[model samples]
Target: MRFISEQRFDNGCLEREFTLGDIPGILWTPSSSPSPLILLGHPGGMNTMYPRLASRARRCAQNGIAAATIELPGRGERPRSAGAERARADLRRALAAGEPVDEIVDRLVIPLVDRAVPEWRSALDALLSLPDVRGPVGYSGGLIALGIRLAVIEPRIAAAGLFAGSFVPRCMFHEARRITIPLHVLLQWDDEANDRQSALDLFDAFGSREKTLHANMGGHMGVPEFAGDDAARFFARHLT
Candidate 1:
């Protein structure tokens, strides 16, 4: 990984912007060394997601855990995917007609998982090579389907904190059944954009014996601060 820029948070956490191959990413390391790592996940768009991501990174730093995230394929400054764009247009039309979007959701989410998972694994390879980042890894945040695939395929990720606020392909339910690591899932009860029953069912599908669901009353962006604290504790329990 090539480090292009660096800065420090007021709390003494170090933030570095870097690139892995063509993918742009950011890494946050706390002032403390030998920190466990958390890989942050989000729905596409790095620029739009930065403020919240920075907040999450600061919290990870406070807890003495390193954190990092990469731009997903076809997001931000990356080349656009015309096929995904077409699938999105199809999704909008299907939604407009009150039609089931199973196929569209599959089309949109599956390929993203396929492409993004490898990039994250590659990022993991590079991040863990650094002296400051060590111990077990945890994954936290949205695009729950991608998180599921990563948790299943990437053995280094010891736990996960999933945000139930994204479209999940049905196939990922089977993949979810393969995940045996600890999981902490946060569901926004009244999220206008998410399917509540599907989120609950997906949670139930996880094969992890140690999974916990925190269903709170809010819109997608309105997760209570205490829930985040709870997730941090969960990671601390498993990763530290």
Candidate 2:
């Protein structure tokens, strides 16, 4: 990792921006010592500087946990893939036409998951190599399909804070059954982009006995601030 710039917050947290190969990322750590790391995944279209991501990272830092986020494939400085564009166009059309959710899942969600999971794993490897980071890593944020795949395949993640506002691919239900880490899934009940039943189905499919659901009655953008607090607490408990 090559350092780009850094700033120190009044709360004694240091936020450093860096580049890993072609990917842009940021790491927030307590100024005093190394802490457990949380790999934050941003919602699609948002990069490492997204308000929620930065806010959550600062929150984790305040709680003595390190937080890091890397740009996803086709995002930030990474070159966009033609396949990703095609899949996104298909998803937009399907959602606009009120097409069946399953078709959208098959056409877009699965392809995105296949492209993103490997990138996430690679980013995790780079983040863990940093001197100020420690084990007992946790994952937070969404693009729920990516979370599902990571939870199922990445044994390094001890817990996850998954946002369920995105489409849940049909194949992911089986993968969800394989996730055994502690999970805290947040859902917006009235989200227009998500199939409510599908979200419930995905959450129900998680095999982790320690999973908890925090559902609120609002639109996709209405996730309350308290939900973030709860997620920070969840990560602190598990990752710490």
Candidate 3:
């Protein structure tokens, strides 16, 4: 990982922008050494998502935890894939027409999960090599499908906090059943882009012996501050 630029916050958290091959990413570290790490997940677009990601990272940093996130495939300055674009258009049209979007969601999300999970693992490999970004690692935020795949496959991630404001691919349901780590799923009850029942059923499908769901009444971006506080506490319980 080659760091491009960096800033030091008053709180003693160091934030750095870096690149992994062609993918761009950011890492935030507390002043303290050997801090536990949380991988911050988001929909896409670092410029659009930086405020929330930094907010969440600061929350973790204050608690002596490290945080990091990478741009998803075909987002930001990365080259776009034609298949993913077609899938996205199909998904938008289905959602706009108020038609069932299960198939479209499968097309849109499954490929993304396939492409992103490995990149995340590679990021973890590099991030963990740093002196301060230590385990046990936790993951937080959306896309929930990516979180589920990592929870199932990445043994280093001991817990997860997922934001369920996006469509989940059908095949991920099977993978969800394989996740045995602690999970804290956040759901916005009135999310326009998400199906409430689908979120509920996905929550039910997780095989984690220790799992909880927090549903609040709001839209996708309306996650309350207290929800983030609760998520930080959840990670602290498992990772700290």
Against the true structure, candidate 1 reaches a TM-score of 0.97
User: Candidates' lDDT values, in order?
Assistant: 0.93, 0.82, 0.91
Question: What order do candidates take by lDDT, descending?
Answer: 1, 3, 2
Worst 10-residue stretch by lDDT in candidate 3?
217-226
TM-score of each: 0.97, 0.93, 0.98
Per-residue alpha-carbon lDDT of candidate 1 for residues 128-239, written as tens digits (9 for 90 to 100): 9999999589999898888999999988999999999999999889999999999999999999788899999999999999999999987988999999999999988998
lDDT of 2 by residue, 27-127 (tens): 88887566788888775655534777778888888889898887777766678888767777887787788876576467766766787788778878877
Candidate achieving higher lDDT, 2 or 3 = 3
- Model 3: per-residue Cα lDDT over 1-240, one tens digit each: 999999999999999999999899999999997899999999888889999899999999999999999999987778898998898899888889999888888888888889999999999999999888778999998889899999999999999999988888878899999999999999999998888999999999999999999998769878888888888899989998
Quality of model 2 by C-alpha lDDT: 0.82
RMSD of 3: 0.9
Of the two candidates 2 and 3, the one with more favorable TM-score, higher being better, is 3
Which of 1 and 3 is ahead in lDDT?
1
Candidate 3 lDDT for residue 126: 97
Which stretches of candidate 2 lie above 4 Å from their native place? none
